[model samples]
Every structure is written in structure tokens, then in C-alpha cells.
Target: MRPLDLLLAVGVMLIWGYNFVIAKYGLAELPPLLFMALRFGLVALLLVPFVRMPRGRWRDVLILAVMLGLTHFSLMFVGLAHVDAAVAAIVIQVQVPASAFLAMVLFGDRIGWRRALGMAVAIGGVAILAGEPRHSSALWAIGLIVTAAIVWAGANIQMKRMTDLDPSTINGWMSLLAAPMLLCASLLIEDGQWQAVTRASGWAWMAVAFQAVIVVIFSYAIWYRLLRTYSVNQTMPYTLLVPVFGVLSGVLFLDEPASWSLLLGGIATLIGVGIIILRRPKAVEAQAQVT
Candidate 1:
């Protein structure tokens, strides 16, 4: 990767990593589904003018809504409600191996022996992390996170199928489709909608706005560019740092405890996934054509 691209990648990672802490703080004052609804609603409004239906392949667009926008965000928000964002960050990193393994089973994609071993180590680390959590709710939260990752992996495949559109166009349309589902879910599940809206503090509104504009709208443009320009496996490893930042932010801001198991499992996850990412195809060559 060029220095600029590398820096961009790291910057994206930091934004995502810090977001866990932000989401944790956001959740303190807002219900998970309600917060998600507002976040997507704002994103939809910002993006609506730019949004266009996916040309020639509407199925890919629908897939993106379900996998990338709806399923991923909803489960993740619910999961965040159950655990610290930092821990959620760490645990969610396993999606790399999950996608790889899913590819192997679903598409017969080859995972050379080394990658196979890495996958094993990563899975073991996740198991240890889940077991180490004292609260049963935390374990369930991990399940929710993994579910979100699975949906995200599916979305990645959908994105790969749509080679016709620019990243911004794709993201705008997907966000638009996803917004209503989230809003309806929130309305059905959450009580006192008008009161909740009125009672929400400025900080909560800021959090929702940041998530909508920064995290989903802006950051995702960068991310989708990366996805389109590089092979899925090639750019995925940078995501490991997300959990590291997540955990640190949690400790520093949320004052969440850092347990031995969390620390060990996190390290194991980073090391194992790092090996997989580094061993995969170089991204420099692929990014050149896109850039």
C-alpha cells in the first residue's frame, strides 16, 4: 500500500475503533434500537438526494440493505447494549476469520494450511473470550456480534457481485433502504417515542448525528472504496486494530474492566488475524487500478 493509502486505512481503523466507545456512551442515554433508528434516519436524509437504485442488478442492492445495513447494524447495536463497546470491538474482529471460513464452506474457496491454522487460533481465542466473561448477558452479546459479522460478510459478497456502481452510490442507496426498517423496528419495540425524542440530551443527539454522518456516511465511503479497490481478504486485517482501540477507549472512557481473558484473547486474535492478513495478496497492486 502507498503511504497515503496506509494512512487512510489506519485513520479509518481509528474512527471505527473510537466509535465503540462513542456508541457505548451513546447507549447510556438512548435505547439501542432507537439510537440506531435515528442514526439511519439522519443518514437516509443526508444521502437521499445522491441515492439511486442499483442499475441492472436490484438484487444486489436488496442484499446490501439486509446484510450490510439492516442486519449488521441492528444486531450490533443490540450486542453493544449487552457489553462494553471495547469488548464488542475486540469480539467483532473475528469476522475476518468468519468470512474466510464461510467462503471456504460456501464457495469452496481455498484456505491454504497456514490460513487454516490462523482461523483455528482465532476461533479458539473467541471461545476463550466468551467463556471468560462473567455475565451471561455478555456471552449472549458476543453471539449477537458474531451474528452481525456474519451478515456483514454476506454483504461483502453482495458488494463483490455489484461491480457496476461507485462506492458512494451503493452506500447511499443501501442506507436509504435500511433506514425505514430500523425506524419501524424502533417504533415497535421502544416506548414513549415522542417523549424519548424530546428528552434526549444534546450529547445524545450529537452522538446520533456523528454515527449517521461520520461513521455510516463518511467513513463508509472510504471503507467501500477500500473494498472495491482491494480483495476482501487483503484489506480486512487492518480491522484487527479496531478492537485494540475499542478496548483501550473502553478502559479510558467507559472505565470498563480489562480482564486477563479479554487481554489474552484480544492479543491472540490480533496475532492470529494479523498473520492471515499479511499472508494474503498484497493490496498495493489492486488499489492502483481503482485510485
Candidate 2:
């Protein structure tokens, strides 16, 4: 990658790293689904006009919205409400291997024994972190986060099928669809929606704005630009920084505890994720084989 693009990749990861903390702060004031509903609504209202429609790809985009915008964010924010952001970041790393494993099962993509071991090690780390919880509710919360990870992996799979569509187009239409879906979910299960909207502070709303603009629009724009230019292997390594920054931001900003189990489990998880992420793609492997 060029120096400027590398910097852009790093910037995206940084915002994502801090996003956990930012979202936690926001969720404290607003219901998780409602918070996401507002974020997507703003993104849709702002970007829908500037971007083209999916036209032929509505099914894929809508599935992505359900997987990522609805199920993943709903479970993630709800999980965030109960667990520490730092650990949540680490545990979510399970998605790295989950994606690989899903690819193997769904598309006959190769993971081999190396990546298989990587998956086990990653899950074991989550198990360790899962044990760190003092209460059963926290375990359930962790499960929710893991389930979110699986859903997110499914969303990635959906994205692979929509490669011809611009990221902006996919996200724009997704936002317009997802906002109402999230609002309905929030209305059905959550109370105090009016109270949250009225009572949320400026900082809380700022957090939502950051997510909508920085994380969604700017960062993902750069991310897709990078992916278009370079191979996945080149950019995947940068994501390792997310949990590092997540831990630091959570520790320094939120004063969340950094117990020994957290340290051990987080390290183990990152190691496993690195093993999976740093691997070359099968297509690249085939190219090399031909050479």
C-alpha cells in the first residue's frame, strides 16, 4: 500500500477501536437498537441522494442490512450494555476465524489444519474470557457478542456476493432499509424510547454522530478504496490494532479493569486471529501454484 493509503487504513482501525467505547457511552443514555436506528437513519438521510441505488442487488443488500445493521448491532450494543468494552473487543475477534470457517463450509474455501487450529485457539481464548465473568448474565452477554460475530461473518459472506456494487451504494440503501427495521425492533422490546431520546446528553448524541460519519461513511469509504487497490491480506493485518486500541481506550478512558485473565485471554485471542488473518487467500495460493 502507498503511505497515504496505509495511513487511511490505520485511521479507519483507530476509529473502530474507539467506537466500542464511544458506543458504550452512547448506549448508557439511549437504548441500543434506538441508538443504531438513529445512526442508520442519519446515514440514509444524508447519503441516499448522493449515491445510486442497488437496483439489481437489493436482495443481497437487504440481507446484509439484516445481518449487520439489525442482528449484529442489536446483539452487540445490547452486549456492550452489560460487558466491558475492552473484553468485548477481544471476544469479538472470534469473528475472524468464524468468517474463515463459514467460508469453508458455505463456499468450499480452504482453511486447512493451520487455520482450523487457529479457530480452536481463538475460541479457547473466548472461553477464557467467558470464564472471567463473575455472573451468569455476563456469560450470556458474551454469548450475545459471539452470536453477533457469527452474524457479522454472515454479512461479510453476503458482501462477497455483491462485489460489483459500490460500498456507498450498498450502505446507503442498507441504511434506508435498516433504520425502520431497527426502530420496529426497539419499539417491540425496549421501553423508555421517548425518555432516552429526550434525556440523552450532547456527548451521547455526538457519539452517534461519530459512528454515522466517521465509522460508517469516511472510514468504510477508505476501507473499500484500499480493498479495491490491494489484496485482503495486505489490509487485514491493520485490524489487529483494533483490540489494542480498544483495550487502551477502555482502560485509560473508562477505567475498566485489566485483570490477568483479560490480559492472557486477549493476547491468546489476538495471536489466533493473527494466524488466521495473515494467511494468504486461496486464489493467491492458486496463482502461486500456477507460477
Candidate 3:
């Protein structure tokens, strides 16, 4: 890859990694489902005008909107509210190995010994992280995130079967569909959303805008380009930096405590995910979702 494109790839990682902290701050001023509703609604408003609608692939598109966009973010933010951004960032990496596990089970994809071992190591690392005594009280929240990761991995598997789906417009359509569903969910399950939206700080609103515009739209646009222009080996490896920046951002920006178990377990998890991502065939393109 060229120097400029490499920098772009790294920029995407930074945007996505920093978003963990961003979402945590955003959640302070907005309810999770309410915030997600606004974020996806704005994304749809911005993107739907530019991209073509998914006419024939509505089945796959709706599945993504409901499962990944609505359900995943709902669980993630709820879990994030009880945990540190660094933990959320690191824990979600479980999806990498889980995706591999699902691929092997559902599609009969070959899981070489190295990958199976990597998956085991990754799961073990997450167990260590989850068992950290400093945050053991939040096990229910952690469990929610783990469940979300598995569901997200399932969405990833479903995406693999959608050979005809266009990456460029699918996010737009998903957002368009999910925004209303999220709004309905928030109304049903949450309280004080009206107060939350009305009394939100400027920075809080900016955080929402940052997530919708920069993280989802801008970074994804660049990442899709990088994936199309370069081999998966060239573009995908830079994503390893997400947890590093995630940890750093939480520590530096949010003053979040980083326990020993967090550091060690996160390292182990990333190493295993590294194995899974790096071992992929050169030609196989990874799904563009980062969160």
C-alpha cells in the first residue's frame, strides 16, 4: 500500500477505536436506544439521498438492520453504560473469533488447527477479562456484550451469504430501517428520553454526530475503498490498532482505570484475534463493520 492510503487505514482505526469513548460520553446525556435512534436516523438522512435503495435484497438488508444495527447497538450501549470504554472496546473483539467459529459451524468453512486454537485462546482471554474482580459486579453487563458479540458474529455470517448485497448502500438502508425500530424500542423500554434529548449538552450532541458521520459514514467509506483497492492482507491488518487506541483513549481522555487483568487479558484476546484475521486468505475480503 502507498503511504497516504496506509495513513488513511490507520485513521479509520483511530476513528473507530476512539468511538468507544465517544459513545460512552454520549450515553451519559442520552439513553442508549434513543441515542442509537438519532445516530442511525441521521445516517440514513445523510446517506440515503446519495445511495441507491436495496430493492431486491430487502430480506438481507432488514436482517442486518434488525439484528446488527438495532439489537447489537442496544445491547452494546447498555453494557457500555456499566463498564469502561476500554473494556467495551476489548470485549467486542470476541466477535472476531466468534465469527470464525460460526463460519466453521454454519458453512463448513475450514478451521485449521491454528484457528481453532486461536478461538480457544480468545474465549479464554475474554473469560479472564470478564472475571476481573475490580468489575465483577458488572457481570450481567459483560454478559450482555458477549451475547451481542455472538449475535454480531451471526450477522457477519449472514453477510457472507449476501453475495449480491452492495456494501456502499447497505448501511444506508439498514439505518433507514433501524431508526424507526430503535425509536419504538426506546419509547417502550426507556424513560426520560424526552428530558435526555432536551437537556443534552453540546458535547453530547457532537458525540452523536461524530459517531454517525465520522465513525460510521466517513471511516466506512474509506475502509470500503481500501478493501476494494488493496488485498485483504494489505488493508485488514491495520485494524489491530483499534484496541490499543481504545485503551489509550479511555485512560487519557476519560481517566478510566485499567486493571492488570484488563491489560493482560486484552493482549491475549487481541493476539488470538490477530491470528484469526491474519490467517485469512489474501483474496478474502473482510466485512467492513468495526464496532
lDDT of each: 0.76, 0.85, 0.86
What residue runs in model 1 are displaced by over 4 Å at the alpha carbon?
A: 1-4, 224-237, 281-291
lDDT score for candidate 3 against the true structure = 0.86
**Tens-place lDDT digits, model 3, residues 75-158:** 988999889999988898888888887777776767888888788888888888988887779999988898899889988767
Q: After best superposition, candidate 1 residue 10: deviation in angstroms?
A: 1.8
lDDT of 2: 0.85
Q: Estimate, for each residue in 198-244, the C-alpha lDDT of model 1 and write its tens digit.
A: 88788788889889888877887887677666765656667777888
lDDT tens digits, residue span 1-291, model 2: 889989888888888999999998898899999999999998998789999875677777888888899999999989988998998899888888888888778878888777777788888888887887563568888999999999888887777677677778888899999999999999999999999999899989998899899899989887877776776767778989999889888998999999888888888899889888777566634332211
Clashes of each: 0, 0, 0
Report the poorest 10 consecutive residues by lDDT, candidate 2: 282-291
Native-vs-model 1 lDDT? 0.76
Evaluate candidate 3 by giving its C-alpha RMSD to the native, one decimal: 2.3
TM-score to true structure, per model: 0.88, 0.95, 0.95
- Looking at model 3, the pairs that clash are none
